[model samples]
Target: MATSKSVLFVCLGNICRSPIAEAVFRKQATDKGVANDWRIDSAATSTYEIGNPPDHRGLACMKRHAVPMRHVARQVTQDDFQSYDYMLCMDESNLSDLNKKASKVKNCKAKVELLGSYDPQKVLIIRDPYYGSDQDFETVYEQCVRCCNAFLEANS
Candidate 1:
């Protein structure tokens, strides 16, 4: 492995889970005073929400919990596989999508991982909050916060 320290969080849409993971990871790193040690980003599996701001609910959820991060939705790019050290997915479907893309990559260096992989004792998938109630968003946010914090602990 390269000594590079960067991570790319991915999900079905950039509107929700991935952005939360990105922000959560960023926040955790900052809290640990290791924010300068890593570069973090997020992307979507599909183009549906590309060029759009993160979903309102996603933002509200973060705001409610006070996990600050703002980003526009974007689709995963070929260049990301080369630029990032790790590519983390929110769930199995997104992981499969990323894998399909990675299979076509030449000299791929990025390690694809599930966001929950950071949570050694409870490897649960981060649930999607797009179609749910505010309470659901809170639940998802809480889970991502925990997983993201764990990621920082293990990696930093």
Candidate 2:
């Protein structure tokens, strides 16, 4: 393992799942008193929401859980393959995208995975709340929170 640990959360767009996962993990690390030991951020596979804030529903979901996240949307960069210890995608589609990119990098491919892999009981996508109702955001928040907590427990 690297001396310093950093994670990059990813999704199709940075507006929903990825940002929420970043916030959830940040909050989880803080709650575990390991915030100083790990770093977390998020990115999009596409540039649709580049430079934009997280989706409004996603923001509300984070606020509801007291997860503080202030992020400007950005597309995943090749440089991130070298920078982060882990690149966690919200689902299989995004994971496939990362895998293809990771394949081009020699050692970096070892560090990418699906966030659902961290789930203890069941695997699931960190569903997109963009086109859905507020409840969708809440559900995504719950899944992200669960995965984030599990990640901290296993890693720390």
Candidate 3:
């Protein structure tokens, strides 16, 4: 059996950007026939939207792109710090928050980084679309596609 590599995508609320990134990466991995080789999931930096479903705009965007997305918002856990191979976050604040959390987790092994770091287009931040228009959600989706593609290629 292939060894498993896990990644956890994180954002402020979990309802907008991170879920989209998780779904996009999953679909890309699946398309490359490596979906089973990796474990993919998403979480939030804050508990504000914990237990809530992804934002409707994000859901619509995923559906439009034919990316299957199903997730409940959850705060990043200490176990995530130790378990995931990578904890990829949306923006600078998320990167800082996750690093702070991971610092407190004994033996944490995950490499926390900005997901946009993988974008070939050099878009270094995936902005939150929570209060933005539907176009903003589409932009998030576009950035995820670029970043996730490069990420998969690098890891493969």
Candidate 4:
């Protein structure tokens, strides 16, 4: 029996990079027929966009790539640190915030790390696209695809 793997993609606001990574990873997993072997989700290190859907630009970017993305922004809770096997974040600030939160959870199980760390291209940051042009969103989507693919490949 194969044990299901679980991961939570996280960022500062949850409206941009994290959601894209989550969607991209999920789509790739489903395409490979292994989505059932994983529990996937996304969240935020901060409360900035809680309860809100992903940014419009991100939605548009996903549409352009034919990737499905549906997520409500949510802040990371101490419980998340226990629920997920891995909690991958967009950048250093999110990584720092998640690590700080994990420190408070006495039984934290999630491994907090940068989602960019999995990028084979060596891109270390998945920038926030809330203020940038649609091109910026495209760049984020491209990076997410690369990083998500590498992460999935490494685990498979």
Best model number under TM-score: 3
- Candidate 3 structure quality by residue, lDDT tens digits, 1-156: 665898899999999999999999999999899999999999999999999999999999999988999999999999999889999999999999998898899999999999999999999999998889999999999999999999889899
**Candidate 4 local Cα displacement, residue 69, angstroms:** 0.9
Backbone clash count, each prediction separately = 0, 0, 0, 0
Query: In model 4, which regions exceed 4 Å deviation?
Result: 1-3
Q: By TM-score, is 2 or 3 better?
A: 3
lDDT of 1 by residue, 1-156 (tens): 333489999999898889988988888888787778888889999999998888888788788767897899999988898788899898889999999999998877899999887765585788888898888777777778778888777776
Prediction 4 global C-alpha lDDT: 0.91
Please give the lDDT score at residue 2 for candidate 1. Answer: 32
What range of 10 consecutive residues in model 2 has the weakest lDDT sum?
102-111
lDDT for model 1, please. 0.85
Question: What ranges in model 3 sit over 4 Å off?
Answer: none
In candidate 2, the residue pairs with backbone N, CA or C atoms under 3 Å apart (3 or more residues apart, or in different chains) clash, namely none
* Candidate lDDT (C-alpha), each: 0.85, 0.85, 0.94, 0.91
Worst 10 residues of 3 by lDDT: 1-10
Count residue pairs with overlapping backbones in model 3: 0
Predicted candidate 2 versus true structure: per-residue lDDT over 1-156, tens digit per residue: 333788899999898999889988988888877888887889999989999999988888788877897999999988899889889898888988988888787557338888888887576677677899999998888888788888878888
Per-residue lDDT of model 4, residues 1-156, tens digit only: 554799999988899999999999999999998998999999988887899999998999899989999999998888888878999998888888888788889889998889899999999998888889999999999999999999999989
